[model samples]
Target: MPDVAEVRRRTWVPGRPVDVLATLGPLRRGAHDPTWRVDPDGTLWRGVRTPEGPATLRLSSRPALGEVAASAWGPGATWLLDSLPALLGAGDDVSGFVPRHPRVVAAGRMFSGWRVPRTGLVVEALVPTVLEQKVTGQEAYSAWRRLVRRHGEPAPGAEGRLWVAPAAVTWGRIPSWAWLQAGVDGARSATVVRSVRAAGRLEECVDLDRVSARRRLRAVPGVGVWT
Candidate 1:
């Protein structure tokens, strides 16, 4: 068995209020997803499948200290901990956004703590996008939730039962029937399979600017604006 690792007590304080759930909640494939959880104490936990391996993370806010404590376990423990701040929206820049309307400004002020998070895992982000093509949100989320629970490796930590998205190779190898069973049509399934076959190239585009990345993604067969 591969050795797993654990890192605990790593913490940081953001300049503004960090609504843990609000910041990272959108990443969850579904409301009842096992990959995302909230503890009784309000700590947020997430499982991710990294290039290295599967990892699980727990985050707790310390209001008095104005910081968030992070703990992670798996072969990707260090990567998860190191990227926690960014995953929690530290790299988001709202300087470019200036709300003109009163309602927009008010909403921004009301949800000041909310920020869009960038997971940095391109293929992970792309998989759901592919699934959602020409389908309803509920259908896409259900397919994602079911597929991940079935094919993904169990997370390393004992904190909770969490599972990561299967590796790119595993994704590429999924049988056509499985996608249908998950409510994904053959066209979308073919696109995802082909995309994962070139996952290495797609992942490398993370270093590229937005335009270049989009162009590269569009070059793949069956991937376009819908994807």
Candidate 2:
């Protein structure tokens, strides 16, 4: 694995490599090595080894101003570390945190170092969230991998992660036929299209309290609890 400290030491533009980690957390979720890579332009990368075979990560951080927010989720401590900053309010007190589940707590301690991590926030989450509504995890993720791998740019560093997601302006330009090919039905496609227009405002939710942030996100025409 590459050196994590070395990657973190580089300077970055507002919207690329630095922010991808800021928003997505570790791309491998709860792997032992737990590494992420960033292309100079901000596209993110990671590697995984499942029982079936090895895998790699590549995606555009697609960050917007104020979009560097992340959320706690999944079955392990990893997400908590990455998303806690947003759930409890950025830079919150972890002293009172006590997990009800023993394993999750143990996992939390294991990954505690990233409590304030950056998960590319903004359009990164926004794009996926828009695709997830009223659909199974399978559907949304399938669409994301397809569209991004096809239309998104390539990663830009020594590492080989996928490129970042398209810009809002670029998202809007994705033709309808492209979404169909990616297996996104019309409704989910529409949400993504509209979200591209409101990318900036949507990311601002990261700055608000979790309740307020989620509520505000729901205010978007197509955004709801499912998103």
Candidate 3:
């Protein structure tokens, strides 16, 4: 088995101390499993469950690396931290959103990892949306895994196939036969193909506020309120 330290080196950060050692706790859930788990302490930990055991990539260490991960994941997390004190400070009651989503609200005991990615949002979120135009989620996720494993890059940390979702350019170039191998049909494939051509346009949604982002996302060729 490889050293956990070696695996740790590949935590996928951009090399900035502030990002690596965030002021608050890790908010990225499932960072330690196939799903990234964000700890209450704000430690964004990503783990690769090896045959030997679990190899963890913790963010609270090595300030420089953490900073990079922070930025690469999108530097908006810093902004979230700044507003957190005001939102949860003295006399600030947040029960409205808490009771609605008890699990998330209660578990969210920190002020980091809230900012969603901009480009990857378009890339990763679009995976299911593109493949699910007229099919089931199982079919879409399955297709995502198949195609990513085939055409996507290797995940920074993991034993099995953790996909680095193909970029827009790559998506635009994927052949139709590849889609079939992943169980995706022509109609859905066409939508993904068309959208990939306008990757920049989809990424533009990231800068907009949540409401506007969703609004513009819906305008994308294959994306919709239901999709």
Candidate 4:
């Protein structure tokens, strides 16, 4: 195996209290997901699928210190570190979401750390979703776990064995039998294959607004309103 890449670190203070879990939960595909690790100390580790290469990111917040520390490894480390703020919710605008009901206001206040994180990687969002369609959660998560562990590169670092999602080319090349063994049927597998084949165009959806991105994603076969 190649020598592990260098680990890099960055730190910053958020404008408001940042709840790392609330912000990052959506990124975790499932409980058995191979792409993320959340330690007991509240640190969040994620293996990102980037255009440059696989990147591993570790984030920990020190409320008393008033800062969140981020560390990255692998070829895309610099890109991951630079995009930390946006990943951690710096770009979300909630000015228009004032809750009218007392219960809604209380719920919002209770989860003040919640923020929508926009990860520009479209295939990252679409692939697992396709696997999830018309399947039990257990089946989908198991397939994701198996495929990633078998095909993905180990995350950079001395600790966890997390793996980044395989690159689009790798995903596109997974054999038909492999999908069957993973409990993914032909329909779902076909959708996944199609999505990865069109990854370049799907990625461009990131540049579009939410409405346009959704429209673009739906244009891909097997992706529909439910997705």
Give per-model TM-scores.
0.92, 0.57, 0.52, 0.94
The most accurate candidate by TM-score is 4
lDDT of 4 by residue, 81-117 (tens): 8888888788998888989999999999999887889
What are the per-residue Cα lDDT tens digits for candidate 2 across 10-71?
Answer: 12233222234543452322222223455587665443221112233344423344233321
Candidate 1, residues 33-116: lDDT per residue as tens digits?
768888898988888877777888889988788898998888877788888888888989888999999999999998887888
lDDT of 2: 0.53
Please give the CA lDDT of all the candidate structures: 0.84, 0.53, 0.48, 0.85
In candidate 4, what residue range of length 10 has the lowest lDDT sum?
1-10
* TM-score, structure 3 vs. true: 0.52
Q: List runs of model 3 lying over 4 Å from the truth.
A: 1-120, 157-161
lDDT tens digits, residue span 118-179, model 3: 22245445655667667765665567656755775543444443334566777888898888
Q: What is the lDDT of residue 135 in candidate 1?
A: 81
Model 2 TM-score, all chains together: 0.57
Total clashes for model 3: 24
lDDT of 2 at 206: 65
